[model samples]
Target chain A: MINRRDFMKLSAVGGGAVFLSGLSQITQAAAAYDDFYFVQLSDSHWGYQGPANPEANNTLRKAVETVNGLELQPDFIMFTGDLTHTTDDPKERRKRLTEFRDIVSDLKVKNVHFIPGEHDASLDNGAAFKEFFGETHYSFDHKGVHFVTLDNVSDPGASIGEAQLAWLAADLAKQARDARIVVFTHRPLFDLVPKWDWATRDGAKVVQILMEYPNVTVFYGHIHQENHHMTGHIAHHSAKSLVFPLPAPGSQDKRTPLPWNPAAPFSGLGFREVEAEDKPFQLKITEFPVTRA
Target chain B: MDLQISKGWKIGTACLAILALVSIGAAHSAAPKTGKERVVKVVAKRFIYTPNEIILKAGVPARLEFTSLDFVHGFKVPDLDIRVDLPPGKVTTVHLTPQKAGVYDFLCDNFCGVGHEEMSGKIIVKD
Candidate 1:
């Protein structure tokens, strides 16, 4: 049974015929399993100190508290990337990563997942990040959904690299064509706005590999804004940042963070809740502000 | 619709395009030798650029030659619509004439190590 919310999401992604035909089959599979949801928090930039976010030090802590305050806690929490600000000093980078890990460890949900953003990994090729977080990229299964975390930022050139692409292809080859796949990465796979460094250089190859699958959704956080795009039938969504918000793509000459508003604290800074329903095979995203206005 | 008018139109368009191309080549070959053109060499490595600050006179053409000593870096001046890729051990040249007198910020858009965000400089164009 398609709900109004599901209908809206489907229509938003050009729901004409291809997606709807598979909906009935997905709805039939709903009887055997229950729906699950996860929280997507990205670009926290924990060690960042700037005028863009006057309350940067306190925002991540407050976000953890806010998530804990939720009525229905998520099954897992995935931090898409940018856990800490980039630092030239390796020691400082590790220190910030350690602090970021400790702060987020306070979250209520124990099954938390993490990936590296450019700020977190590009410096030493994700070496420091691997010390805190186990691996830069990995895949797992949850409630019939295949979740693949990609390491696009570890390379200074913002590429997924040829080796990782082979691994991804081999991994996807094992799954059925209709498998529901969710990809998490720090950078957007498609070239949204290359001038602002919002694009992954080899993202097109990633998109091409996923095009074989019928059900795939990509969630990424680099632009620090909520954006949605479709590469054929696949949908790619960008998450907002916990530290600061960037202006819309191509809206300005520079991709500078929006000025902080004194009257409106924590404006444009928010997180997301993604509910994955198996019956209709839909991922519903609800954006929440870091703090109540 | 007549043959004579059609032929005349094509000939007229061809003559005008040739004239435009010749004039454009002349302007390109003549402008740089006027003695006002300045050449600035910049070296990029790790997270900083050498001689980060550059000054130029408005309306004077300048050539900015960029080279990367380490990783590949991008020299982007968004306001001036200049974006150049400086590969390691390669020299890339960009020429521009600032029509306006103002301070323009340029940065290494490419991610070079950890302090990529701090790799920035300003181009000061004086009136």
Candidate 2:
């Protein structure tokens, strides 16, 4: 439901006509567009076997079931990263990636997107990840919004690199100042926490380029918990991990995964759906649990 | 409220404190000791490490003294199970004895700057 604040924001950006129009007219105007929503599932960490998540083998399958159960299936589903756990053996890594791919293929929405997390790409410089998921970075247009995916994890040092930066700059050059742009990345563009390996090495440069556009939102997942922050006017949102939860940034000395509580299974594992409508770009984010309570 | 301690109680408390201190000292002394210490001073900048290739004798303890010239950096030898955080303007030291002779790659695990990905080194442990 659009509250008073949301209405004011919509009216302000919708121009003077929207301001003069009655509330009923505004509702009609909002419904008169091809709005779309997409699902985001991140850090599945498939093939991970540990005490932190006793049901690691089944979590990803259950998440697929949950998404399939959505009353309204998203237009597309995006996996932010960590499709598979890190493995020293290249063959094992590919095996895990194949298993993860097979599990996610059951999604009702065949149109899916993916990016790499450090666990999936860093060891072999994205060779295995690329083999399975095509290019590490690319852009696509859906409905009235533009979506760009950046690879920050392929490089072990957690950098987006100069080449990708130039590509992003050129990509943005074609769009209008107020164009609705959405960025999907595994690591946050802004430095959330460097010590814990939470921030991207060259993330500031990427953020600088993104700051040029007025309407841009970055959706990322690596911290394994939900976090929201803003750099200038750009909003950065991180999603929860399907494997296990981590403590808040800098809350403890070590960034260890929070131990699984037998009483509350799958407490911090889930995915989210983000709905967007243009005209005056507005977003509605709804989070869904991987399993019902 | 008036509280008083008897001489016997005071003596017992003093004895417990002394025992605890002695135990702690013994534990400290039992910790691993660097044998035939070999100091290797390394410097870190934006995305490079000075003397990136290091050579050490297997079974000989080496003290790695790391200093970051610019931002905070990290030294992580994943296979060797060694990780250290080097804050700028400070000396962070790590000690290890290479029991096996092999080439172990080490990288700056911390995100320094733009060129951080290329910041890596190797330790050649000679038999």
Candidate 3:
């Protein structure tokens, strides 16, 4: 399934098995983690199979392994998106979804929340994503925290349409003011570069609504790397991909497909262990590798 | 490998390869010479390509080795038109020859955001 462009990129890298070690334990551990609980995993890319990360399918299972081993069991797990590569075939997307579900079947945690990326939505604008994973953009409450997920990938790249913004407004209307709100999506709100493939067109409106909430935090994935920034009252955090890392931005002249590195795939992939303190609606993320803790 | 067997294909490839090789060699004649086929190491961890910019000699296919320390990263040189998806637990080698001198750019084209754009660097192909 490699196009001329895709194939060239794939063929350029020298091949060999690269066994990498995950980062050693990182836990600011203290009574601070006694409150709420959540885990953020992104860019599973279930259907993506290549030398970039040969174990792309199994890595998700390993992430689940990390989730199961957490000392403080998360109340739920939030997967931002990019559940598959690019394919408009419903059957292929569904198959990938099925595999995603199967990977979690072994997990000890019962509840896992998810959002969509462009890949999973390629088939009928996330029709497969919604059908397989449930509502794309919706909100819910667990104790004192209000968790919201917006559908930024419903459009071309990362975008939250006008109708969806109206819905987000209506959704926020139901939450109490003091409730700590956490929004999830697949792209960053900042203008990473509108020309290539970074910024989300309608993310500004979503940010506008989010600004209304006091202690709001947004979690996103898509730009398969780790990034953290504070947009006024809203703090944006992007999750690392279980698949591969990408250029920062404009690192290259053109935004092209990165080649497949045979030796290593799990190099930059890590999970964020977020513990939410229920009483005050506060959440803290401690980045950790999926390796045995 | 792309140059053989079929008549039309062979003729086309022979011409392109010869064109590329000859042009590349001509460009190499102007070296004040910063360096030659230097070893550049890049580490990918948690979505970041460390020490992104890699200096090299123009008009020569240099060997660049990269590995991911954390997650999967894609090291791509758009001007050179090369892209490599680096995964953890693997070492990847990319051989590229930038014909035209000057500064050619490389980026984390995989959309490793927030600073993904900043995750870019230059392959200072010294003349």
TM-score (C-alpha, index-matched) for candidate 1: 0.75
Candidate 3 regions exceeding 4 Å error are A1-34, A254-265, A278-281, B1-127
DockQ comparisons of all candidates to the true complex: 0.25, 0.08, 0.02
Better of 1 and 3 by TM-score: 1
Residue pairs with backbone atoms closer than 3 Å in model 2 (clashes): none
TM-score of chain B of each: 0.72, 0.72, 0.62
Off by over 4 Å in 2: A1-33, B1-127
Write one digit per residue (lDDT tens) for candidate 3, span A1-293. 54322332332232111111111121222222235556788888887776667677678889888778754466788888887775546687688888887887787877888888877773367788887788888888775567888887766434577898999899888865544677888888765644355667667887888777666787888777777776776678787787776666657565543555556446677777565543333454566665552
lDDT tens per residue, model 1, A1-293: 87544544553343111122122234334123457778899999988999999999999998898888766678899999999998889999999998998998899999999999998998789999999998998999888788999999998778899999999999999887777788999999997876567788789999999989878899999999888888888788898899999999879766778999989988888888777765467777777788642
**Cα lDDT of all candidates, in order?**
0.77, 0.75, 0.63
Docking verdict class for candidate 2: incorrect
**Which docking band does candidate 1 fall into?**
acceptable
lDDT for position A98 in model 2: 95
What is model 3's native contact fraction?
A: 0.00
lDDT of 2 by residue, A158-241 (tens): 778999999999998987665677899999887676445677878999999998877788899999988888788788889899
Better of 1 and 3 by DockQ: 1
Highest-scoring model, lDDT: 1
lDDT of residue A88 for candidate 2: 70
Best by TM-score: 1
